[model samples]
Target: MAPRNGYTGEGGSSVISTDLSHGSVESGESLQSTSSPHRCHHVMRPARKVAFVYAATGRRFLGCPLSGPDRCSLFMWIDEAWGPVLSRSLIQLWDQAFLDSGRAARLQTKKKEMEQAYLELWTERSNMEIENQQVVNKLKTTILDTEIKMSRRLEFHTKMCVAFISSAVTLASVLAYVLSAH
Candidate 1:
């Protein structure tokens, strides 16, 4: 029977069938029919592609289109299920690919976060350095001001000492001259 849009099978799963007569998928050759261990038939609807990550590696598989609770348990790998060893290897490869892609995405997100944090820390450090330099400059200015005040006070004290000594010598000379005259 010709598969129609929104068609449901007896198992209650939505089915989207592909026309095999076209013999080509868009531009490439049509996908030949093959038996799978899990699905009734391999359904290829480009518009209805799904990424199935449960099949060991993260690979896209042909499964029921219905999502959530309505989705059917149809898990069929895209690659051919040939000999036992070959099929197992293929599944492993697909699973690894999926895992690697997921990890890569997470690592990229982490790298961005780290870069932002580093930039913030650098900015904080620069601000602190500027503040420290300002404090140093202020300290130097204060010391210089204190030294200038102390120097001025010392000069004033020295001049006062000289004037007092001169006045005492002149007074003693006058007393001695008066006593000698008497």
Candidate 2:
């Protein structure tokens, strides 16, 4: 039997008898033909024009029509019984690519942050070293000043002792001369 919409009986077993001539079959009705020729004819349909966009690659595939097996592979229908398999695959790939890019960016940012922190730490360490050197210089100066003051005090003490000895000698000589003259 001739299928509706000018479909030659190419699909599965026809609901109507296949022995009957093509013109005898009524339109808009299934056939019951078990013959391989009729079944092949029923299965074969004109390829429809389809356009698909791959989400992952941002690429478009045009004029690619899906067969019966290809239609079953897709999870969702695109439109007019077309499968969204290619589109869905493209979308998944695109999502993965975006995620990878995001991860890479985050890592790069983190690395920069770490480098900045390291530089700051180095600067602080250098400043501390300068301050330490200054402190050492001040300590050395204080020590030198204390040594000079101690040396001056020792010299003054030595001069006082010499003057006292000279005075004692002069007193003794005067007593002896006066006694002898008397």
Candidate 3:
């Protein structure tokens, strides 16, 4: 005989396992049953991380995901305590190590930023130095051009002065010859 879901015969001892709402089954057809067991599936939630203070003294633990009505009442300690003093000291050391690593990471970032700024400043300084050299070259060329112009002007003035002196000397000698002949 197959298992039944509800009460069936005489003293209610005979149970039929198939659902009667889907279809009616006669007593003759009870021997030809093909029903499976009732399986209840429950979803398992993951544990949550929690920090305990006071008596736990800043320790960490994993608690059940549920609370209130459907709580699974699950709890597990992440940190094991050696003793009060030693555990607190270890926790403090771990905290300090974590803080130190964070500080080191921040310092590394700042160092990179400073290095990048320094590189930019160096590049700008190099560009400025090149610009200054170009300006100096342009100034030297301008001075050279001005000096050539000035030298040419001086040469022209000197030739004009020599011509004026030669003309005065020739005119004076001719005037003296005429006066002496008279």
Candidate 4:
């Protein structure tokens, strides 16, 4: 007869065995008929709590309670097997979420840096335009001053030439009169 719960024999006998020794039983009939309480202990009990752990910190967190359907879905031969599966799944999802958040933060930082660079470039361009305009103004002022000086020199030379021509004409007329009188 197959054992029920912790009982093994028909007359009600208590059998005790560790998990390592019971794991060698391959046949289902042999596993059920085993006269050891330890062999059936893993098959009789449902898993109660599942725990998830952070790989970096090794801190464990309790997961959600399993429903009746979920408990019934597990095989009786495995002990607390669903806990590790669920914990690993949750940890993988959390890791992906963290990685995505980090990438978004890096992109935001890059955007801020680009904006600052553009502002600095714009400011420099404005300053350069102002300096260029000042240089143009200075050149215009110098050209105007040079043109005024050239005009004044030309007027003085014209006056000197007229005075010399008049003096030469009067001297020549006076010499001709003296020669005729002698």
Best by TM-score: 2
What tens-digit string does per-residue lDDT give for candidate 3 at 1-182?
11223323322233323222222112111111112222112234333232322234333334444443464444455446447775566457546755787899999999999999999999999999999999999999999999999999999999999999899888899999999999
Give the 10-residue window scoring lowest on summed lDDT in candidate 3.
Answer: 25-34
Give lDDT for model 2.
Answer: 0.45
* TM-score, cand. 4: 0.46
Ranking of predictions according to lDDT: 3, 1, 4, 2
In angstroms, give how far residue 44 of model 2 lies from its true place.
Answer: 38
Candidate 3 lands at a TM-score of: 0.45
Q: So what's the TM-score on candidate 1?
A: 0.46
RMSD versus native structure for model 2: 18.3
Candidate 2's clash total is 15
After superposition, candidate 4 runs with Cα above 4 Å error: 1-82, 166-182
Once fitted onto the true fold, the runs of candidate 3 whose alpha carbons sit more than 4 angstroms away are 1-92, 177-182
Could you give me the TM-score of model 2 versus the true structure? 0.48
lDDT of 1 at 61: 45
C-alpha lDDT of all candidate models, in order = 0.51, 0.45, 0.52, 0.46
TM-score of each: 0.46, 0.48, 0.45, 0.46
